[model samples]
Target: MTEMLAHELRTARAPISAHLFVSGFTYTGMISSWLPDKPDAACTSEETVSHLVERLEHGDFYILCPDNEVTPEIDRKRVAWAAQDIIENRPALSRWHPDFAERFAAFEKPDRNVEKV
Candidate 1:
């Protein structure tokens, strides 16, 4: 919904841009309370915010942040798969459906454990 709104606003009100900052596995008090301990893959809220600032400074319109668990490449693959879901006329979230699990796993395997320093 926000993405659609951003596009509409950008079209109607020119010269202004709306950016979306997407984060994964952020560690906060609420999240901590849900688990016995914080996971190593989760980034602290401060770290997430700092990265957001850095990306914004770099003029990134759509920022998909990398936590310890998920890297940028993996995020890109996921986004591409999501778009394919619509284009391919598959059911919503087919990636998680049992019938499509094997295919999704194959598509995601190349991205797994591939990260930058």
Candidate 2:
């Protein structure tokens, strides 16, 4: 989808107190529609923003709006902050199997001698 469409969807909310039921099973974050009361009802893209705002005001869900458009500067800062967080946390890197450092270290080591018959 285009960036404009995404921005519009993010900004639209209506019904002044409707709950948006994002499917927990969906990993792609694509919603078919926003229901006013029934969770299964399909809502148009235009109706989503207003519906969301309404729900948020009624304490149905917490709304977190972006302060500004995602510019290059903002993107760069986000990446920098994420890198800093990772460095500070120092979480285990074992998940990245066959690590480059580990491979390089093995390659640099001298080969061991084997017994001959």
* Candidate achieving the largest lDDT: 1
* Candidate 2: segments with Cα more than 4 A from true spot: 1-29, 35-68, 90-117
lDDT of 2 at 19: 34
Q: Give the per-residue lDDT of model 1 (tens digit) for 13-88.
A: 9666677989988999988778868799999899999999999899777889889999787788878888888988
The true-versus-predicted C-alpha distance at residue 13 of model 2, in Å, is: 49
Model 1 gets an lDDT of: 0.82
Model 2 C-alpha lDDT per residue in residues 63-103, reported as the tens digit of each score = 32222233333333333444543765633442233543453
The 10-residue segment with the lowest total lDDT in model 2: 108-117
Clash count (model 2, backbone only): 9
Q: Quote the positional error of residue 41 for candidate 2 in Å.
A: 24
lDDT of 2: 0.38
